[model samples]
Target: MVKDLVCTLKSARKREICCSRTTRAIIIDEPTPGLKSIFHIIILDQRSGKAEVQYQHDYVGISTCIGFNANPVINFSGVFGTNAFALGTDVAFDTASGNLAKYNAGLSFSTADLIAFLTLNDKFDTLIASYYHTVSPLTSIVVGAELTHSFSTNENTLTIGTQHALDPLTVVKARVNNFGKASALIQHEWRPKSLFTISAEVDTRAIEKSAKVGLALALKS
Candidate 1:
């Protein structure tokens, strides 16, 4: 099978030319027995002086993730210098009968002020936990929550979701959150490596800037 390659060019809203960025990603599957990985790299304009690299790997029981950022390329001080390193990992366990449990945590911090930041923000890290229980051959329930806290901000969210298989090729998911948010997703697979998905989210409490709708199509060869 041939994997798809993707490239994207992005820029900031304020200075499009100075901060222009090009990002490339390559994904490989089954290069070896039970191993797959993705390599990603991004480059800011040669004139702008910035770069980053990220790698992701997955295997039978666990996956590893880590990345680094170099903004301004030269400055080694303050928040920009302190927050240059990004690291995290996620792990999941599956039972023979299709039950699943997962845990993930990650943090971004400055290399220079690691000790100071770690001491003060021990409780202000990002954490996620989830569990899925198979109710029937065609249905399952999932419950998950995420907490993010740092000097800059804090957020806590809880989610409950359900998946139902309507038929061999059609599946649907409905979810709700403690923050008065609700969403639904429908997926249909037409054939091998071809998928269609429709998703929408609405804020019941009508919070500002809290609604989203999306449609996506995927084709693989």
Candidate 2:
């Protein structure tokens, strides 16, 4: 459970306060046996000029979520089965318009060594699939593709990527897509929870073009 409260001044004399609360209840314990269920609820005050309530539940092999907002929009999503094999759908409806704002569905399968997903999106006009595999303890690879069809155009894309850990503190990653663009990055943890990274990208098809480079550093306290 969590709660947040904020105070703000609307003017020289007017003041406003907003509160938000979140609660979680375990309906069934994991150790209790056959089926386990959990419920979560969230309430938001008028501080944001909107009152909202959200609820989520996970029971047996099914997970469900629902949200209601001040905009009069309702969002719902559910997934069935475990991570090893599951199917899910997400959709949003606008009460004002009485129409579906968005909808998508996906299926996923996972194992100790690999995981894969297939999804239909954009009202079923687009399809995407991805695969990931643990090549070794220190290396892994991923591949993904997307296809979209519309009244005027059809688009397709594919990408492949891999990551390898050089040591406990250093790692490197590289990826390339069918669009002739390639990128690689290396990151090293210089100190506890601190890291430095360098990355570069180039257009394989047009070598004459200038390459892009980037550097980043993060420090944690």
Candidate 3:
């Protein structure tokens, strides 16, 4: 795929102008052999002041294949916190993201199970975080005081939007809800590392007033 090929180069599939020294990429909705709904992303150097290309994956999208029963009825008859969706097996994504908020744009599962599971349970990552059209961000996903977030129960719902309140934590379990659209149950994911060193160093003075703008451009589509 073009994203894959672009990721292989110094340039990230995010598609950026030449004036900057940073590049980012994301692994779109392709369930590679051993991979689940994962987005392989790399930041030239945003979080850490050092010049390094950090790679990560988060399970935000996935749908059942023809053979598998999408979103199997998860008889949460087990425990309160137990995930209602069987979520097939945990498939690895290139990145991992979550928060313990009440609702969240959830894992890549099936629409049926997602709603059913939500009815059976509560305490999800802030239900319906954001909506999006594509997986691989053509540009960035971040905004001022707001950062772009992507979520999916599966292919049924893949969204990209900005969230005012941001929490950087991993969500353990969630109960699918019926009120909103259904999504895929994302399994585990694996982040593909770059063979070369992905590095960056953004100076406050260089970005100045545009630092926040640059961040917004760097994360949101």
Give the CA lDDT, 0 to 100, for residue 154 in model 1. 63
Where does the lowest 10-residue lDDT sum fall in candidate 2?
51-60
RMSD each, Å = 17.3, 9.2, 22.2
Using lDDT as the measure, name the better of candidate 1 and candidate 2. 2
Backbone Cα, N, C clashes tallied per candidate: 2, 0, 54
Model 1, 90-203: lDDT tens digits are: 433333334323444443544331211121223325444344455565343333333333444566566777778887788888888777899999999988879999999999
Candidates ranked by TM-score, best first?
2, 1, 3
1 against 3, candidate with superior TM-score: 1
Query: Mind giving the per-residue lDDT tens digits that candidate 2 earns over 1-221?
Result: 44565443343332333433433232333434444444433444445433333333342233333334545666677777675888888787877788988898999899988888889888777778888887786443334343333423576777788888888788888888878889999999999999999999999988678589999999999
Per residue, candidate 3 scores C-alpha lDDT tens digits across 1-221 of 23322223323223322323344434433334443232322334334432222222232333211111322221111111223333312222211233322212232223321222222113331233332222223332232111222233332333322312112221111122222321222122122221111122223344443222111112222
lDDT of 3 at 42: 31
| TM-score, cand. 3 vs. native | 0.17
TM-score of each: 0.40, 0.73, 0.17
Better of 1 and 2 by TM-score: 2
Local lDDT at 121 for model 1: 29
Q: Arrange candidates by lDDT, highest first: which order?
A: 2, 1, 3
